[model samples]
Target: MKPIGLDKAEHAHVESSNNATVNSEKLDLSKVKVEPLFEKFVDFDTFTKSDFRIVKVKNCEEVPKSKKLLKFILDDGSDKERVILSGIKDNYSAEELVGKTLLAITNLPPRKMMGIESCGMLLSAICEYDGEEKLNLIMLDSNIPAGAKLY
Candidate 1:
């Protein structure tokens, strides 16, 4: 999704205002703005039916030979487990990510990344600054059941 009129000065101002340091080497959200030609609406029911759920991150490890890939083992409150690969290594450490709950798209078809089979996608908000990508994993409060659907 594109954000309109997003510019480097605006990005730096926002980050500094929030007391969030812009990791220029990793994420730079100051060069491009969202172009204005994208659709702005979606079918509510169909969109709601998309399989977004809360899952506990049981394990996390770096994918061999890949600097960006991190493999995660997630529990979705079922006997079957889901394995996902996310490009958040630059943003998070394995120890910090383990035992945390994340929202995931559980029904996506499996895709191979770095020879690893990923069955789902861990969802996070991303921002680009100076052509660098940064991820903000969704945080939750209290204890929510794993596999609880996002409404």
Candidate 2:
């Protein structure tokens, strides 16, 4: 059965975002190494304290004096725009990330980095692939509205 709010025509069954296929062939799993799972699990109440939401990139630019940081102006379904700085410049360019939908933790306390107050944290995946470190930001489907909470 479809979820409570979903319509029958909405089913697309799209492929996973990180399929990482090349020429219609899947990447060899042997060359990829993921980190071990956490030894301790947090209680459900503590997990729910984290407010994960969808955010849309309105504008993105390289931060001055930082080679690995990119500044982002995001639409988090709020009246005011949100600013976030991420250190993913080595893997992604600012121009390529504009207008993309992404997942972020919205209720974190503001933290200072490079003299900027980043209000939240963007979610990402990291692993060792092909003997090198690789990071991919947790992108969401464009259809998901900004500030939609994740369960």
Candidate 3:
């Protein structure tokens, strides 16, 4: 593939620089599929109504007896700890997620999953890779403090 705004030599340099840390062969996107972008548009006012914030995971554990759920105890800069349940057990283990910073929509109304009240929803990227579904949580930099609002 041709690189935009870069000459052949410059593009080769960039690709070589990344090869030390990234496998260039896996950069191919031909087998990956993503959902179509939303056809409907929302006004800025309506879009800003959703509260997106950075939250630190204080604890994460599999919801007992459930195969797809993971319960998260989060620090959202509030006095009370926030609890959100995400169906990501298949993608990540609780031990691997604790203490990680993540993005979440914190203003959603509470909903019960497995009889537990989930107060918010964590953001994730979902797509089909080589005909198989994949999910990845939206992780944030560790230096970003919890409760920081996203514009």
Question: What are the per-residue Cα lDDT tens digits for candidate 3 across 1-151?
Answer: 1111222133222234323211232333565578999999999999999999999999999999998899999999889999999988877889978999999999999999999999999998777766777676887778999999999
Residue 2 displacement (Å), model 3: 30
- What Cα-based lDDT does every candidate model obtain? 0.72, 0.80, 0.80
TM-score to true structure, per model: 0.71, 0.83, 0.83
Candidate 2: global Cα-lDDT?
0.80
Q: List the residue pairs that clash in candidate 1.
A: 3-34, 8-30, 28-128, 28-129, 28-130, 29-128, 29-129, 30-129
Shift of residue 50 alpha carbon in model 3, Å:
0.3
Candidate 3, residue 34: Cα displacement in angstroms equals 1.0
Question: Model 1 lDDT vs. the true structure?
Answer: 0.72
Candidate 1 local Cα displacement, residue 123, angstroms: 1.1
- Residue 98 Cα positional deviation in candidate 3, in Å, after optimal superposition: 0.4
Please report, as a residue range, the 10-residue window in candidate 2 with the lowest summed lDDT.
Answer: 1-10
Give one digit per residue, the lDDT tens place, for model 1 in 30-146: 453343555777778878777988999888998889987899998987888789998877777778778887788888889999888999888776655445544567755429888
Q: After superposing candidate 1, which stretches have Cα over 4 Å from the reference? A: 1-38, 129-132
